[model samples]
Target: MIEAQGLTKRYGRKAAVSGLDFRVEPGRVTGFLGPNGAGKSTTMRMILGLDLPTSGTVTVNGRRYQGTVWPLHQIGALLDARAVHPGRSAYNHLHSLAAANGIPRSRVEAVLDQVGLTPVARKRAGGFSLGMAQRLGIAGALLGDPGILLFDEPVNGLDPDGILWIRTLMRSLAAEGRTVLVSSHLMSEMALTADHLLVIGQGRLLADTPLNELIARDAANRVEVRAVDHHRLADDLRTLGGDITLKPDGTLLVTGLDSASVGELAAARGHVLHQLRDVTSSLEDAYFRLTENSVVYRTPVPA
Candidate 1:
Protein backbone atom coordinates (compact mmCIF):
# COMPACT_ATOMS: atom_id res chain seq x y z
CA MET A 1 0.00 0.00 0.00
CA ILE A 2 1.00 3.62 -0.54
CA GLU A 3 0.17 6.43 1.87
CA ALA A 4 0.60 10.19 1.73
CA GLN A 5 -0.14 12.69 4.46
CA GLY A 6 -0.11 16.42 3.87
CA LEU A 7 2.19 15.94 0.92
CA THR A 8 3.26 19.15 -0.81
CA LYS A 9 5.76 20.49 -3.35
CA ARG A 10 6.75 23.96 -4.57
CA TYR A 11 8.86 25.40 -7.37
CA GLY A 12 10.07 28.88 -6.51
CA ARG A 13 6.86 30.83 -5.90
CA LYS A 14 4.43 28.37 -7.48
CA ALA A 15 3.01 25.37 -5.63
CA ALA A 16 3.10 22.21 -7.71
CA VAL A 17 1.36 20.03 -5.16
CA SER A 18 -0.36 20.93 -1.92
CA GLY A 19 -1.55 18.81 0.97
CA LEU A 20 -2.31 15.72 -1.09
CA ASP A 21 -3.39 13.27 1.60
CA PHE A 22 -4.63 9.95 0.33
CA ARG A 23 -4.00 6.22 0.65
CA VAL A 24 -3.79 3.74 -2.19
CA GLU A 25 -4.63 0.27 -0.93
CA PRO A 26 -3.65 -3.11 -2.33
CA GLY A 27 -5.80 -5.33 -4.58
CA ARG A 28 -7.16 -2.39 -6.60
CA VAL A 29 -6.31 -0.36 -9.70
CA THR A 30 -6.48 3.31 -8.74
CA GLY A 31 -6.50 5.76 -11.65
CA PHE A 32 -4.81 9.14 -11.15
CA LEU A 33 -6.56 11.81 -13.22
CA GLY A 34 -6.08 15.54 -13.62
CA PRO A 35 -6.24 18.29 -16.17
CA ASN A 36 -3.07 19.56 -17.82
CA GLY A 37 -0.66 21.13 -15.30
CA ALA A 38 -2.71 19.75 -12.41
CA GLY A 39 0.37 18.15 -10.85
CA LYS A 40 -0.41 14.50 -11.60
CA SER A 41 3.13 13.82 -12.83
CA THR A 42 4.68 15.83 -10.04
CA THR A 43 2.73 13.85 -7.45
CA MET A 44 3.90 10.57 -8.99
CA ARG A 45 7.48 11.80 -8.93
CA MET A 46 7.13 12.56 -5.25
CA ILE A 47 5.78 9.07 -4.57
CA LEU A 48 8.82 7.54 -6.28
CA GLY A 49 11.18 9.94 -4.47
CA LEU A 50 12.33 11.56 -7.72
CA ASP A 51 11.09 14.90 -6.34
CA LEU A 52 11.29 15.70 -2.69
CA PRO A 53 8.14 17.06 -1.07
CA THR A 54 8.52 20.43 0.52
CA SER A 55 6.26 19.34 3.40
CA GLY A 56 4.49 16.21 4.68
CA THR A 57 5.52 12.70 3.70
CA VAL A 58 4.81 9.73 1.41
CA THR A 59 5.47 6.08 2.22
CA VAL A 60 5.34 2.65 0.64
CA ASN A 61 4.32 -0.15 2.96
CA GLY A 62 4.74 2.15 5.96
CA ARG A 63 8.33 3.18 5.13
CA ARG A 64 10.03 5.80 2.98
CA TYR A 65 10.59 4.35 -0.51
CA GLN A 66 14.14 5.71 -0.89
CA GLY A 67 15.05 4.41 2.54
CA THR A 68 14.40 0.82 1.55
CA VAL A 69 17.38 -1.49 1.06
CA TRP A 70 15.97 -2.58 -2.34
CA PRO A 71 13.87 0.29 -3.58
CA LEU A 72 13.10 -1.39 -6.90
CA HIS A 73 11.81 -4.51 -5.14
CA GLN A 74 9.49 -2.44 -2.95
CA ILE A 75 8.15 -0.10 -5.62
CA GLY A 76 8.35 -0.31 -9.43
CA ALA A 77 7.47 2.59 -11.71
CA LEU A 78 7.18 3.22 -15.48
CA LEU A 79 7.00 7.00 -15.49
CA ASP A 80 8.90 7.40 -18.78
CA ALA A 81 9.25 4.58 -21.29
CA ARG A 82 11.88 6.29 -23.39
CA ALA A 83 14.28 7.08 -20.59
CA VAL A 84 16.42 4.03 -21.47
CA HIS A 85 19.83 4.30 -23.12
CA PRO A 86 19.41 4.06 -26.90
CA GLY A 87 22.75 2.33 -27.37
CA ARG A 88 21.81 -0.71 -25.25
CA SER A 89 19.89 -3.74 -26.45
CA ALA A 90 16.67 -4.58 -24.62
CA TYR A 91 18.38 -7.50 -22.90
CA ASN A 92 21.39 -5.39 -21.97
CA HIS A 93 19.14 -2.68 -20.56
CA LEU A 94 17.26 -5.00 -18.25
CA HIS A 95 20.45 -6.82 -17.36
CA SER A 96 22.10 -3.58 -16.33
CA LEU A 97 19.17 -2.46 -14.16
CA ALA A 98 18.90 -5.87 -12.54
CA ALA A 99 22.63 -6.05 -11.94
CA ALA A 100 22.72 -2.65 -10.31
CA ASN A 101 19.85 -3.68 -8.06
CA GLY A 102 21.24 -7.20 -7.31
CA ILE A 103 18.57 -9.02 -9.37
CA PRO A 104 19.52 -12.31 -11.02
CA ARG A 105 19.92 -12.74 -14.79
CA SER A 106 17.18 -15.39 -14.89
CA ARG A 107 14.65 -12.82 -13.72
CA VAL A 108 15.61 -10.55 -16.62
CA GLU A 109 14.73 -13.22 -19.17
CA ALA A 110 11.49 -13.99 -17.35
CA VAL A 111 10.43 -10.32 -17.45
CA LEU A 112 11.39 -10.07 -21.11
CA ASP A 113 9.09 -12.96 -21.93
CA GLN A 114 6.38 -11.54 -19.70
CA VAL A 115 6.34 -8.23 -21.60
CA GLY A 116 6.54 -9.99 -25.00
CA LEU A 117 9.98 -8.55 -25.65
CA THR A 118 11.79 -11.91 -25.87
CA PRO A 119 11.85 -11.76 -29.66
CA VAL A 120 13.55 -8.33 -29.62
CA ALA A 121 15.68 -8.88 -26.52
CA ARG A 122 18.89 -8.42 -28.53
CA LYS A 123 17.65 -5.45 -30.58
CA ARG A 124 18.93 -1.98 -29.80
CA ALA A 125 16.36 0.16 -27.98
CA GLY A 126 16.95 3.13 -30.31
CA GLY A 127 15.54 1.12 -33.24
CA PHE A 128 12.45 -0.03 -31.35
CA SER A 129 9.02 1.48 -32.00
CA LEU A 130 7.09 3.37 -29.36
CA GLY A 131 4.95 0.37 -28.55
CA MET A 132 8.02 -1.84 -28.23
CA ALA A 133 9.68 0.68 -25.94
CA GLN A 134 6.61 0.73 -23.73
CA ARG A 135 6.74 -3.03 -23.39
CA LEU A 136 10.42 -2.90 -22.54
CA GLY A 137 9.78 -0.31 -19.87
CA ILE A 138 7.05 -2.44 -18.31
CA ALA A 139 9.43 -5.41 -18.29
CA GLY A 140 11.95 -3.41 -16.31
CA ALA A 141 9.34 -2.38 -13.80
CA LEU A 142 8.28 -6.00 -13.31
CA LEU A 143 11.90 -7.10 -12.99
CA GLY A 144 11.78 -6.89 -9.21
CA ASP A 145 8.18 -8.11 -8.82
CA PRO A 146 7.41 -5.17 -6.58
CA GLY A 147 4.18 -5.02 -4.56
CA ILE A 148 3.54 -1.42 -5.58
CA LEU A 149 3.39 -0.42 -9.27
CA LEU A 150 3.07 2.99 -10.93
CA PHE A 151 2.41 3.43 -14.63
CA ASP A 152 2.13 6.79 -16.43
CA GLU A 153 0.30 6.60 -19.77
CA PRO A 154 1.19 2.97 -20.39
CA VAL A 155 -0.94 2.93 -23.54
CA ASN A 156 0.35 6.14 -25.10
CA GLY A 157 1.71 4.53 -28.27
CA LEU A 158 -0.12 1.21 -28.19
CA ASP A 159 -2.44 -0.12 -30.85
CA PRO A 160 -5.92 -1.39 -30.05
CA ASP A 161 -4.72 -4.90 -29.36
CA GLY A 162 -1.81 -3.63 -27.31
CA ILE A 163 -4.15 -1.45 -25.29
CA LEU A 164 -6.34 -4.42 -24.47
CA TRP A 165 -3.28 -6.45 -23.48
CA ILE A 166 -2.12 -3.68 -21.13
CA ARG A 167 -5.56 -3.47 -19.50
CA THR A 168 -5.55 -7.19 -18.77
CA LEU A 169 -2.02 -7.10 -17.39
CA MET A 170 -2.83 -4.25 -15.00
CA ARG A 171 -6.01 -5.98 -13.78
CA SER A 172 -4.09 -9.21 -13.20
CA LEU A 173 -1.46 -7.34 -11.21
CA ALA A 174 -4.12 -5.86 -8.96
CA ALA A 175 -5.75 -9.27 -8.64
CA GLU A 176 -2.47 -10.49 -7.18
CA GLY A 177 -3.09 -8.09 -4.25
CA ARG A 178 -0.66 -5.44 -5.38
CA THR A 179 -1.15 -1.69 -5.21
CA VAL A 180 -1.44 -0.29 -8.71
CA LEU A 181 -1.56 3.43 -9.51
CA VAL A 182 -2.11 4.48 -13.12
CA SER A 183 -1.85 8.03 -14.43
CA SER A 184 -3.58 8.58 -17.75
CA HIS A 185 -5.62 11.11 -19.71
CA LEU A 186 -7.73 8.37 -21.30
CA MET A 187 -10.99 8.61 -19.41
CA SER A 188 -12.80 5.83 -21.28
CA GLU A 189 -9.93 3.41 -20.76
CA MET A 190 -9.72 4.32 -17.09
CA ALA A 191 -13.46 3.71 -16.73
CA LEU A 192 -12.96 0.13 -17.85
CA THR A 193 -9.61 -0.57 -16.16
CA ALA A 194 -9.77 1.21 -12.81
CA ASP A 195 -11.83 0.24 -9.79
CA HIS A 196 -11.17 3.51 -7.96
CA LEU A 197 -10.14 7.05 -8.90
CA LEU A 198 -7.87 9.75 -7.48
CA VAL A 199 -8.69 13.09 -9.07
CA ILE A 200 -6.66 16.22 -8.51
CA GLY A 201 -6.93 19.78 -9.83
CA GLN A 202 -4.33 22.51 -9.45
CA GLY A 203 -2.30 20.23 -7.15
CA ARG A 204 -5.15 19.80 -4.69
CA LEU A 205 -7.25 16.71 -4.14
CA LEU A 206 -10.73 17.20 -5.64
CA ALA A 207 -11.96 13.66 -5.28
CA ASP A 208 -10.78 10.27 -4.04
CA THR A 209 -13.47 7.62 -4.40
CA PRO A 210 -14.69 4.60 -6.29
CA LEU A 211 -15.18 5.07 -10.03
CA ASN A 212 -18.89 4.21 -9.93
CA GLU A 213 -19.55 6.56 -7.04
CA LEU A 214 -17.99 9.51 -8.80
CA ILE A 215 -19.99 8.75 -11.92
CA ALA A 216 -23.20 8.48 -9.98
CA ARG A 217 -22.66 11.69 -8.05
CA ASP A 218 -21.45 13.98 -10.81
CA ALA A 219 -22.90 12.58 -14.03
CA ALA A 220 -26.54 13.31 -14.59
CA ASN A 221 -28.72 10.33 -15.40
CA ARG A 222 -30.89 11.04 -18.40
CA VAL A 223 -33.82 9.12 -19.84
CA GLU A 224 -34.29 8.35 -23.48
CA VAL A 225 -37.82 8.16 -24.79
CA ARG A 226 -39.43 7.55 -28.16
CA ALA A 227 -43.10 7.56 -29.00
CA VAL A 228 -45.42 8.20 -31.89
CA ASP A 229 -46.49 11.44 -30.22
CA HIS A 230 -42.93 12.76 -30.00
CA HIS A 231 -43.96 16.38 -30.18
CA ARG A 232 -46.40 16.12 -27.25
CA LEU A 233 -43.87 14.16 -25.21
CA ALA A 234 -41.18 16.76 -25.90
CA ASP A 235 -43.55 19.51 -24.79
CA ASP A 236 -44.37 17.70 -21.53
CA LEU A 237 -40.66 17.07 -20.87
CA ARG A 238 -39.85 20.69 -21.54
CA THR A 239 -42.29 21.59 -18.77
CA LEU A 240 -39.83 19.99 -16.37
CA GLY A 241 -37.39 22.77 -17.31
CA GLY A 242 -34.73 20.28 -18.48
CA ASP A 243 -32.55 20.51 -21.54
CA ILE A 244 -33.87 18.33 -24.33
CA THR A 245 -32.07 17.52 -27.54
CA LEU A 246 -33.63 15.63 -30.40
CA LYS A 247 -31.34 13.22 -32.15
CA PRO A 248 -31.25 12.89 -35.89
CA ASP A 249 -32.38 9.32 -35.39
CA GLY A 250 -35.72 10.53 -33.95
CA THR A 251 -34.87 9.76 -30.33
CA LEU A 252 -35.38 12.32 -27.59
CA LEU A 253 -32.58 12.77 -25.06
CA VAL A 254 -34.16 14.16 -21.90
CA THR A 255 -32.04 15.34 -18.98
CA GLY A 256 -32.79 16.69 -15.49
CA LEU A 257 -35.25 13.85 -15.00
CA ASP A 258 -34.93 10.23 -13.93
CA SER A 259 -36.50 7.25 -15.69
CA ALA A 260 -39.36 7.04 -13.18
CA SER A 261 -40.13 10.71 -13.55
CA VAL A 262 -40.09 10.51 -17.31
CA GLY A 263 -42.38 7.49 -17.26
CA GLU A 264 -44.83 9.22 -14.94
CA LEU A 265 -44.91 12.30 -17.12
CA ALA A 266 -45.66 10.17 -20.20
CA ALA A 267 -48.41 8.33 -18.35
CA ALA A 268 -49.92 11.58 -17.12
CA ARG A 269 -50.14 12.78 -20.72
CA GLY A 270 -51.81 9.45 -21.67
CA HIS A 271 -49.28 8.98 -24.47
CA VAL A 272 -48.21 5.63 -25.79
CA LEU A 273 -44.52 5.06 -25.02
CA HIS A 274 -42.43 2.84 -27.27
CA GLN A 275 -39.22 3.20 -25.29
CA LEU A 276 -38.30 4.63 -21.91
CA ARG A 277 -34.81 3.87 -20.68
CA ASP A 278 -32.30 5.48 -18.38
CA VAL A 279 -29.00 6.53 -19.87
CA THR A 280 -26.18 6.78 -17.38
CA SER A 281 -23.33 9.22 -17.94
CA SER A 282 -20.02 8.10 -19.37
CA LEU A 283 -16.68 8.50 -17.59
CA GLU A 284 -15.71 11.34 -19.87
CA ASP A 285 -18.88 13.23 -19.07
CA ALA A 286 -18.35 12.94 -15.31
CA TYR A 287 -14.70 13.85 -15.62
CA PHE A 288 -15.51 17.03 -17.48
CA ARG A 289 -18.20 18.04 -15.02
CA LEU A 290 -15.86 17.52 -12.06
CA THR A 291 -12.80 19.14 -13.53
CA GLU A 292 -14.50 21.84 -15.57
CA ASN A 293 -13.29 24.52 -13.22
CA SER A 294 -9.94 22.89 -12.57
CA VAL A 295 -8.71 23.21 -16.14
CA VAL A 296 -5.66 25.49 -16.21
CA TYR A 297 -5.45 26.17 -19.93
CA ARG A 298 -8.36 26.33 -22.30
CA THR A 299 -8.40 26.09 -26.05
CA PRO A 300 -11.14 27.67 -28.10
CA VAL A 301 -12.78 25.67 -30.83
CA PRO A 302 -12.56 27.11 -34.33
CA ALA A 303 -15.71 28.36 -35.91
Candidate 2:
Protein backbone atom coordinates (compact mmCIF):
# COMPACT_ATOMS: atom_id res chain seq x y z
CA MET A 1 0.00 0.00 0.00
CA ILE A 2 1.03 3.62 -0.57
CA GLU A 3 0.30 6.31 2.01
CA ALA A 4 0.95 10.06 2.10
CA GLN A 5 0.43 12.37 5.04
CA GLY A 6 0.57 16.14 4.69
CA LEU A 7 2.65 15.68 1.54
CA THR A 8 3.65 18.92 -0.15
CA LYS A 9 5.89 20.22 -2.90
CA ARG A 10 6.88 23.77 -3.91
CA TYR A 11 9.05 25.56 -6.38
CA GLY A 12 10.21 29.16 -5.82
CA ARG A 13 7.22 29.94 -3.59
CA LYS A 14 4.79 28.28 -6.00
CA ALA A 15 3.08 25.32 -4.35
CA ALA A 16 2.74 22.37 -6.68
CA VAL A 17 1.09 20.07 -4.16
CA SER A 18 -0.20 20.84 -0.67
CA GLY A 19 -1.16 18.68 2.23
CA LEU A 20 -2.04 15.62 0.18
CA ASP A 21 -3.28 12.86 2.49
CA PHE A 22 -4.51 9.65 0.98
CA ARG A 23 -3.88 5.92 0.75
CA VAL A 24 -3.62 3.71 -2.30
CA GLU A 25 -4.45 0.30 -0.92
CA PRO A 26 -3.72 -3.09 -2.39
CA GLY A 27 -6.22 -5.19 -4.38
CA ARG A 28 -7.72 -2.18 -6.21
CA VAL A 29 -7.03 0.24 -9.04
CA THR A 30 -7.02 3.87 -7.87
CA GLY A 31 -7.30 6.58 -10.50
CA PHE A 32 -5.45 9.86 -10.02
CA LEU A 33 -7.46 12.66 -11.63
CA GLY A 34 -7.04 16.40 -11.87
CA PRO A 35 -7.47 19.31 -14.19
CA ASN A 36 -4.48 20.62 -16.11
CA GLY A 37 -1.73 21.89 -13.78
CA ALA A 38 -3.41 20.39 -10.71
CA GLY A 39 -0.14 18.73 -9.56
CA LYS A 40 -1.08 15.11 -10.27
CA SER A 41 2.24 14.42 -11.99
CA THR A 42 4.09 16.11 -9.14
CA THR A 43 2.45 13.88 -6.56
CA MET A 44 3.25 10.77 -8.59
CA ARG A 45 6.85 11.92 -8.94
CA MET A 46 7.11 12.32 -5.18
CA ILE A 47 5.72 8.82 -4.62
CA LEU A 48 8.42 7.38 -6.89
CA GLY A 49 11.18 9.46 -5.24
CA LEU A 50 11.92 11.36 -8.43
CA ASP A 51 11.20 14.68 -6.69
CA LEU A 52 11.70 15.53 -3.04
CA PRO A 53 8.66 16.78 -1.15
CA THR A 54 9.04 20.10 0.55
CA SER A 55 7.10 18.85 3.56
CA GLY A 56 5.39 15.71 4.92
CA THR A 57 6.07 12.19 3.71
CA VAL A 58 4.93 9.53 1.26
CA THR A 59 5.77 5.86 1.80
CA VAL A 60 5.33 2.56 0.06
CA ASN A 61 4.56 -0.33 2.35
CA GLY A 62 5.51 1.79 5.37
CA ARG A 63 8.96 2.60 3.92
CA ARG A 64 10.07 5.53 1.79
CA TYR A 65 10.70 4.59 -1.85
CA GLN A 66 14.29 5.83 -1.62
CA GLY A 67 14.98 3.56 1.34
CA THR A 68 14.04 0.35 -0.42
CA VAL A 69 17.09 -1.83 -1.17
CA TRP A 70 15.53 -3.39 -4.29
CA PRO A 71 13.24 -0.61 -5.41
CA LEU A 72 12.04 -2.37 -8.56
CA HIS A 73 11.03 -5.43 -6.58
CA GLN A 74 8.98 -3.29 -4.22
CA ILE A 75 7.37 -0.97 -6.76
CA GLY A 76 7.38 -0.40 -10.51
CA ALA A 77 6.38 2.69 -12.43
CA LEU A 78 5.86 4.04 -15.97
CA LEU A 79 6.05 7.82 -15.75
CA ASP A 80 7.18 8.49 -19.31
CA ALA A 81 6.87 5.89 -22.03
CA ARG A 82 9.68 7.38 -24.06
CA ALA A 83 12.29 7.70 -21.33
CA VAL A 84 14.35 4.83 -22.75
CA HIS A 85 17.66 5.42 -24.57
CA PRO A 86 17.01 6.13 -28.22
CA GLY A 87 19.96 4.00 -29.34
CA ARG A 88 18.87 0.84 -27.53
CA SER A 89 16.59 -1.91 -28.78
CA ALA A 90 13.39 -2.63 -26.84
CA TYR A 91 14.88 -5.87 -25.53
CA ASN A 92 18.13 -4.17 -24.66
CA HIS A 93 16.31 -1.40 -22.84
CA LEU A 94 14.43 -3.81 -20.61
CA HIS A 95 17.54 -5.96 -20.26
CA SER A 96 19.47 -3.04 -18.84
CA LEU A 97 16.77 -2.34 -16.24
CA ALA A 98 16.65 -6.00 -15.22
CA ALA A 99 20.42 -6.04 -14.88
CA ALA A 100 20.41 -2.97 -12.67
CA ASN A 101 17.72 -4.45 -10.42
CA GLY A 102 19.29 -7.92 -10.38
CA ILE A 103 16.30 -9.40 -12.14
CA PRO A 104 16.80 -12.54 -14.18
CA ARG A 105 17.36 -12.23 -17.93
CA SER A 106 14.51 -14.68 -18.44
CA ARG A 107 12.20 -12.19 -16.75
CA VAL A 108 12.99 -9.68 -19.47
CA GLU A 109 11.82 -12.08 -22.15
CA ALA A 110 8.75 -12.95 -20.09
CA VAL A 111 7.67 -9.34 -19.73
CA LEU A 112 8.37 -8.58 -23.39
CA ASP A 113 6.06 -11.40 -24.37
CA GLN A 114 3.58 -10.39 -21.69
CA VAL A 115 3.35 -6.94 -23.27
CA GLY A 116 3.15 -8.44 -26.80
CA LEU A 117 6.50 -6.95 -27.84
CA THR A 118 8.25 -10.22 -28.62
CA PRO A 119 8.00 -9.69 -32.36
CA VAL A 120 9.74 -6.30 -32.14
CA ALA A 121 11.84 -6.99 -29.04
CA ARG A 122 15.04 -6.54 -31.02
CA LYS A 123 13.87 -3.39 -32.81
CA ARG A 124 15.33 0.00 -31.86
CA ALA A 125 13.10 1.76 -29.31
CA GLY A 126 13.61 5.10 -31.05
CA GLY A 127 12.00 3.71 -34.21
CA PHE A 128 8.95 2.38 -32.37
CA SER A 129 5.65 4.24 -32.48
CA LEU A 130 4.17 5.75 -29.35
CA GLY A 131 2.02 2.64 -28.86
CA MET A 132 5.01 0.35 -29.16
CA ALA A 133 7.01 2.54 -26.78
CA GLN A 134 4.15 2.33 -24.31
CA ARG A 135 4.27 -1.44 -24.52
CA LEU A 136 8.00 -1.47 -23.91
CA GLY A 137 7.59 0.82 -20.91
CA ILE A 138 4.98 -1.53 -19.49
CA ALA A 139 7.29 -4.48 -20.02
CA GLY A 140 9.98 -2.69 -18.06
CA ALA A 141 7.54 -1.92 -15.26
CA LEU A 142 6.64 -5.59 -14.96
CA LEU A 143 10.28 -6.74 -15.26
CA GLY A 144 10.69 -7.14 -11.51
CA ASP A 145 7.18 -8.49 -11.00
CA PRO A 146 6.71 -5.93 -8.26
CA GLY A 147 3.70 -5.91 -5.94
CA ILE A 148 3.04 -2.19 -6.60
CA LEU A 149 2.59 -0.48 -9.99
CA LEU A 150 2.04 3.10 -11.11
CA PHE A 151 1.15 4.04 -14.66
CA ASP A 152 0.77 7.57 -16.05
CA GLU A 153 -1.35 7.83 -19.19
CA PRO A 154 -0.62 4.25 -20.13
CA VAL A 155 -3.16 4.39 -22.95
CA ASN A 156 -1.82 7.49 -24.62
CA GLY A 157 -1.31 6.96 -28.38
CA LEU A 158 -2.60 3.38 -28.08
CA ASP A 159 -5.09 1.88 -30.50
CA PRO A 160 -8.46 0.66 -29.28
CA ASP A 161 -7.15 -2.86 -28.85
CA GLY A 162 -4.06 -1.70 -26.99
CA ILE A 163 -6.20 0.42 -24.70
CA LEU A 164 -8.43 -2.56 -23.88
CA TRP A 165 -5.41 -4.79 -23.30
CA ILE A 166 -3.84 -2.39 -20.82
CA ARG A 167 -7.17 -1.92 -19.07
CA THR A 168 -7.50 -5.65 -18.60
CA LEU A 169 -3.88 -5.93 -17.45
CA MET A 170 -4.29 -3.25 -14.75
CA ARG A 171 -7.45 -4.91 -13.46
CA SER A 172 -5.72 -8.29 -13.39
CA LEU A 173 -2.81 -6.83 -11.45
CA ALA A 174 -5.19 -5.40 -8.86
CA ALA A 175 -7.04 -8.70 -8.70
CA GLU A 176 -3.76 -10.38 -7.78
CA GLY A 177 -3.64 -8.11 -4.70
CA ARG A 178 -1.13 -5.64 -6.09
CA THR A 179 -1.35 -1.97 -5.27
CA VAL A 180 -2.10 -0.22 -8.57
CA LEU A 181 -2.33 3.52 -9.11
CA VAL A 182 -3.01 4.96 -12.57
CA SER A 183 -3.18 8.55 -13.78
CA SER A 184 -5.07 9.35 -16.95
CA HIS A 185 -7.27 12.01 -18.51
CA LEU A 186 -9.62 9.42 -19.97
CA MET A 187 -12.66 9.55 -17.75
CA SER A 188 -14.59 6.86 -19.64
CA GLU A 189 -11.75 4.40 -19.31
CA MET A 190 -11.20 5.35 -15.68
CA ALA A 191 -14.88 4.75 -14.96
CA LEU A 192 -14.48 1.27 -16.37
CA THR A 193 -11.05 0.45 -14.89
CA ALA A 194 -10.76 2.15 -11.50
CA ASP A 195 -12.44 0.95 -8.32
CA HIS A 196 -11.51 4.08 -6.40
CA LEU A 197 -10.36 7.62 -7.16
CA LEU A 198 -7.94 10.28 -5.87
CA VAL A 199 -9.00 13.66 -7.20
CA ILE A 200 -6.90 16.77 -6.75
CA GLY A 201 -7.38 20.41 -7.67
CA GLN A 202 -4.91 23.25 -7.20
CA GLY A 203 -2.52 20.70 -5.68
CA ARG A 204 -4.92 19.89 -2.88
CA LEU A 205 -6.83 16.70 -2.28
CA LEU A 206 -10.37 17.34 -3.56
CA ALA A 207 -11.68 13.85 -3.01
CA ASP A 208 -10.50 10.39 -2.06
CA THR A 209 -13.50 8.15 -2.43
CA PRO A 210 -14.89 5.09 -4.13
CA LEU A 211 -15.74 5.51 -7.80
CA ASN A 212 -19.50 5.14 -7.31
CA GLU A 213 -19.53 7.46 -4.33
CA LEU A 214 -17.83 10.28 -6.21
CA ILE A 215 -20.29 10.03 -9.08
CA ALA A 216 -23.28 9.93 -6.77
CA ARG A 217 -22.13 12.72 -4.55
CA ASP A 218 -21.12 15.35 -7.10
CA ALA A 219 -23.56 14.58 -9.91
CA ALA A 220 -26.89 16.32 -9.86
CA ASN A 221 -29.86 14.09 -9.07
CA ARG A 222 -32.11 13.96 -12.10
CA VAL A 223 -35.07 11.87 -13.20
CA GLU A 224 -36.90 11.43 -16.48
CA VAL A 225 -40.62 10.96 -16.80
CA ARG A 226 -43.15 10.58 -19.60
CA ALA A 227 -46.87 10.34 -19.29
CA VAL A 228 -50.05 10.60 -21.35
CA ASP A 229 -50.94 13.90 -19.70
CA HIS A 230 -47.41 15.33 -19.81
CA HIS A 231 -48.31 18.98 -19.35
CA ARG A 232 -50.71 18.31 -16.46
CA LEU A 233 -48.24 15.94 -14.80
CA ALA A 234 -45.45 18.52 -15.15
CA ASP A 235 -47.68 21.17 -13.59
CA ASP A 236 -48.51 18.86 -10.69
CA LEU A 237 -44.86 17.99 -10.20
CA ARG A 238 -43.96 21.71 -10.18
CA THR A 239 -46.59 22.28 -7.50
CA LEU A 240 -44.84 19.55 -5.45
CA GLY A 241 -41.54 21.53 -5.64
CA GLY A 242 -39.91 19.73 -8.58
CA ASP A 243 -37.71 21.58 -11.04
CA ILE A 244 -38.88 20.46 -14.47
CA THR A 245 -37.73 20.96 -17.98
CA LEU A 246 -40.00 19.94 -20.82
CA LYS A 247 -38.03 18.42 -23.65
CA PRO A 248 -38.86 18.92 -27.31
CA ASP A 249 -39.44 15.17 -27.45
CA GLY A 250 -42.19 15.57 -24.82
CA THR A 251 -40.32 13.95 -21.94
CA LEU A 252 -39.88 15.81 -18.68
CA LEU A 253 -36.39 16.22 -17.22
CA VAL A 254 -36.95 16.56 -13.53
CA THR A 255 -34.97 17.43 -10.40
CA GLY A 256 -35.89 17.94 -6.75
CA LEU A 257 -37.83 14.65 -6.84
CA ASP A 258 -37.06 10.98 -7.34
CA SER A 259 -38.65 8.41 -9.66
CA ALA A 260 -40.60 6.69 -6.90
CA SER A 261 -42.04 9.94 -5.66
CA VAL A 262 -42.98 10.98 -9.19
CA GLY A 263 -44.60 7.63 -9.84
CA GLU A 264 -46.64 7.74 -6.63
CA LEU A 265 -47.76 11.27 -7.36
CA ALA A 266 -48.80 10.35 -10.89
CA ALA A 267 -50.72 7.34 -9.57
CA ALA A 268 -52.55 9.49 -7.02
CA ARG A 269 -53.41 12.04 -9.70
CA GLY A 270 -54.73 9.33 -12.08
CA HIS A 271 -52.08 10.28 -14.68
CA VAL A 272 -51.22 7.34 -16.94
CA LEU A 273 -47.46 7.08 -16.68
CA HIS A 274 -45.64 5.79 -19.76
CA GLN A 275 -42.13 5.94 -18.44
CA LEU A 276 -40.38 6.74 -15.15
CA ARG A 277 -36.66 6.23 -14.63
CA ASP A 278 -33.75 7.81 -12.83
CA VAL A 279 -31.27 9.62 -15.04
CA THR A 280 -27.92 8.50 -13.76
CA SER A 281 -24.97 10.77 -14.50
CA SER A 282 -21.83 9.54 -16.19
CA LEU A 283 -18.37 9.79 -14.63
CA GLU A 284 -17.53 12.66 -16.93
CA ASP A 285 -20.53 14.61 -15.67
CA ALA A 286 -19.52 14.14 -12.06
CA TYR A 287 -15.88 14.94 -12.81
CA PHE A 288 -16.83 18.22 -14.45
CA ARG A 289 -19.06 19.18 -11.56
CA LEU A 290 -16.37 18.39 -9.00
CA THR A 291 -13.53 20.12 -10.83
CA GLU A 292 -15.36 23.05 -12.39
CA ASN A 293 -13.78 25.55 -10.05
CA SER A 294 -10.43 23.80 -10.09
CA VAL A 295 -9.84 24.13 -13.81
CA VAL A 296 -6.86 26.36 -14.45
CA TYR A 297 -7.17 26.65 -18.22
CA ARG A 298 -10.63 27.38 -19.44
CA THR A 299 -11.56 27.48 -23.07
CA PRO A 300 -14.07 30.10 -24.10
CA VAL A 301 -17.31 28.48 -25.14
CA PRO A 302 -18.84 29.68 -28.41
CA ALA A 303 -21.65 32.06 -27.70
The TM-score leader among the candidates is: 2
Q: Model 1 off-target regions past 4 Å? A: 219-221, 224-256, 262-276
**Residue 6 shift from truth in candidate 1, angstroms:** 1.8
Local distance difference test, candidate 1: 0.91
Residue-wise C-alpha lDDT for candidate 2, range 1-303, written one tens digit per residue: 999999999998999999999999999999999999999999999999999999999999898998577789988899999999999999999988988889999999999999999999999999999999999999988989999999999999899999999999999999999999999999999999999999999999989999999888754457899999899999999999999999998999998888888988998999998889988888898888789999998899999
The candidate that wins on lDDT is 2
Residue-wise lDDT of candidate 1 within 105-165, one digit each (tens)? 9999999999898999999999999999999999988999999899999998999999999
**Which whole-number lDDT from 0 to 100 does residue 8 have in model 1?**
94
Instruction: Give candidate 1's root-mean-square deviation (CA, Å).
Output: 2.8
